[model samples]
Target: MENQWLQVSYADLLQATDGFSSANLIGVGSFGSVYKGILECFETVVAVKVLNLLQQGAFKSLAAEWEALRNIRHRNLVKILTVCSSINFNGNDFKALVFEYMPNGSLEKWLHPNVDEQPQLRNLNLTQRLNIAIDVASASSSSFENTNHDLKPGNVLLDDDMVAHVGDFGLARFLSEAAESCSQNQTSTFGIKGSIGYIPPEYGMGGKASKYGDVYSYGILLLKMITGKRPTNDMFKDNQSLHHFAKSAFPEQVMEIIDPRLLQENAEAFLDSENHNNLKNKMRDCLVALVRVGVSCSAESPGERMEMREIAMEMHAVRDLYLEVGIQ
Candidate 1:
């Protein structure tokens, strides 16, 4: 899509925004503030992502944003409808991106299960999780998915429809001749590059992100969904990570505690089988499948990866098992 500089004058934006009042603020991000805006053209509702001007190099974020979304196609990836600029402080000129509003906010907000959200929507179900995974998997394998480096969770977006769409391509690169392209999961002692809780230990080992890295992060997200926990320096202080803890227990019942909204029937299985040991075995197998995918993709030894296409196929198989046996 050709980039359309915003049609409304920057002056008009100031008037409509009441001098950029905090009330208009939607979310604060690494770049800048996001505001809900109504355009003069169609009176359309949109999300305006504004980056810090004082930070100066914000243009790279814009280029990265553009690189991430421009030509690629996927229902799971957010779509940028237009670009706009606002004059604020001399150093911090406002650079903004307008997107179709996502009523659900973000997976981060939902995964965290905060007070601001609807009590009824406390967590995402297996189908919802799998659907999102599938969406990301599809994007991870797309031509745009081919990045020199890895993808970050911050780049992923969920619309009001609950459809997951990945955005922000600036940091993404084609799987290098040897890498899986992403990983942020790291040990508490050492932080990873992107989001803290999401990085992999291998990343702490100075390894690059790969499909496996994404897998690892996905596993963490799964654990978060199942446990309703947050990442902290002492996250595992009780000697349990959402991963190890979930793996150590029975998912059939306790897993419901992870995401208050999950029905007992939904936690029964993921990759398949009611024939495993404790919830540990069942979950171990499921996560083993997941971690295997993540590890293989992130293997410093690149030859080990199953490639994005294979990764997507494998996830589909696991999802089929969930749908066939997991519906509550």
Candidate 2:
């Protein structure tokens, strides 16, 4: 169905989200909260992203998201349904964006699930992770890079079919050529404009938003997917980073740093396959190619990073070869 923005009332949202109860709160961000709710008008479950207008820059974030998403549509990008801008019962301004609810939740929870709450780690097999990387790359290659300055695992959501959709465009900037040319040294009044570790080196140095910066964040996310480690891990201190950590183990010792869960799955396949040696070699090659792309795209220098188009093409090739191996 074609997506369209509907006029929704604050009272409607209140009922749909059960008065925004703690139970309905699915996720919280720096400027807003997301709640899972049933939208009676659409006859479907939706995510309500309520903006905290009281917070500094919150209105601007909402405006940024609206400007970024209003004209975009892509299979790999999150679908925004409608927006509500009105007064709350408390005589205060209320703003919320309704989005298609994702059943599987964010890639963050899956990558680093809490064992206390989820006894079984939600393991994303090699094939699944590869596909997700491809999906995000596809989204990155789109106009969303006009710039989605925040491309992290937490902003990637999965649907019922496990298709990855990049969302949360609060940090997005729609730039023109003239503006972009002069943006190299421009600083954001909102500070760095991205999560730590995911922010590109150039951005921290007062560079303005750019597609290259998005590519850098995508690179970090891709590496995180393969390694099952956050870029901000305690181990990545004293000048160390996720990029260096992965690059240090590239090609040869990839197996050592890769997520053990992925290795365990491959081990099971090897035990059952008569061509186990060939299978092992192919998997190694696939992983090596992935790491190389991740490392190349996340170079410290923006000029050194891979283009989003090239990254998408490489990920698609990797996923195709992986599926051909009959591992999925």
Candidate 3:
């Protein structure tokens, strides 16, 4: 498998990306910027994530991602095609990772489409949204069981078929048996391991990275999907957070706070039903159960959060129920 990886260098990438033109620039994050390039040797489009060597933890982030993806292979996790550790034309250190291109882009765009996106591409229906939630849970269940310190929507990429793939392991850490306890979870060099709104509360209090912290972040991500709001949305000011916002409406008013677009998409289906009232009741029940899981997982205390394995299993059951009920 090692031999199968195409050996690439700064010149190869520069040529592929036409000198890393901003037109080919796709995404940017704390550690580095990602560029869409056509690797000549592979003759395929790939995402080149070039690390910012001057950044505080750039080297550590590169090492962390490599360690996280080295032995892991999951359909829902982004595939690392190859890596380049070389020097640029100016004799500066250049490090980058090549990844399979995801044409559908990030979940963040789907949740909050930019003005430039066509109106038709703005919303994800209930079924698609549920599937994405399940995909993230499955990946987090398998991967976070070890640890992926960052688990926000922006880090979730979608393939051509819209399958969610967890990526950006720049903050990932493994939780050995010796590091599963509260004190151990506090063990880390990265100051704060995740994005705001998605970060667990404990992390703000100097807590270390842990699977439980990952669960908290996943919970917030799930809630964001359901509500169609980012954790840092302007509406979430004061003591009102995405968690409390959802929790305040759980079970009863959940249907009220759901992404209006989601309601609009399903409105026609409900209206077409001869027993529209019954269908509404069933849909409400399904949504209530999902919100319950989200609230449970995002509880203020780590001990109060649900395990990722349990979340994956529960999400599976919810998807099955959604399909079985003909809710689409």
- What are the runs in model 2 whose C-alpha is more than 4 Å off? 1-4, 119-121, 174-193
lDDT of 2: 0.83
Candidate 2: clashing pairs of residues: none
Residue-pair clash count for candidate 2: 0
TM-score for each candidate, following the candidate numbering = 0.70, 0.92, 0.92
Note the residue pairs that clash in candidate 3.
186-208
Q: Compare candidates 1 and 2 on TM-score and give the better one.
A: 2
Per-candidate Cα lDDT values, in order, are 0.57, 0.83, 0.82
Top lDDT: which candidate number?
2
Q: Please write out the lDDT profile of model 1 over residues 1-328, one tens digit for every residue.
A: 3435446555555555556678978677555777777665667777777667665335666666666566555676777777766566554466667777777677666665558768565567656776777787787776644453234444556886788776654332321211332242322222333356665556555465455565555555545544556544365777555555554454344433344455443344432545424444444345345434543443333454456678789888767655544332
Minimum summed lDDT over a 10-residue window in model 2 is located at 174-183
Better of 2 and 3 by lDDT: 2
Runs of candidate 1 exceeding 4 Å displacement: 1-8, 15-19, 89-92, 116-118, 148-155, 171-193, 201-216, 231-233, 237-260, 263-306, 326-328
lDDT of 3 by residue, 1-328 (tens): 3886778889999998999999999899878899999988879899999999998668778878877776778999999988899999999999998899999899998888889878566679888988999999899888447655578888999999999999988754532221344353353323344476776776656565678888888889988888888888899888889889999997779998888887888788888989888878777777887889899999999999998999999998888877866867
Candidate 2 lands at a TM-score of: 0.92
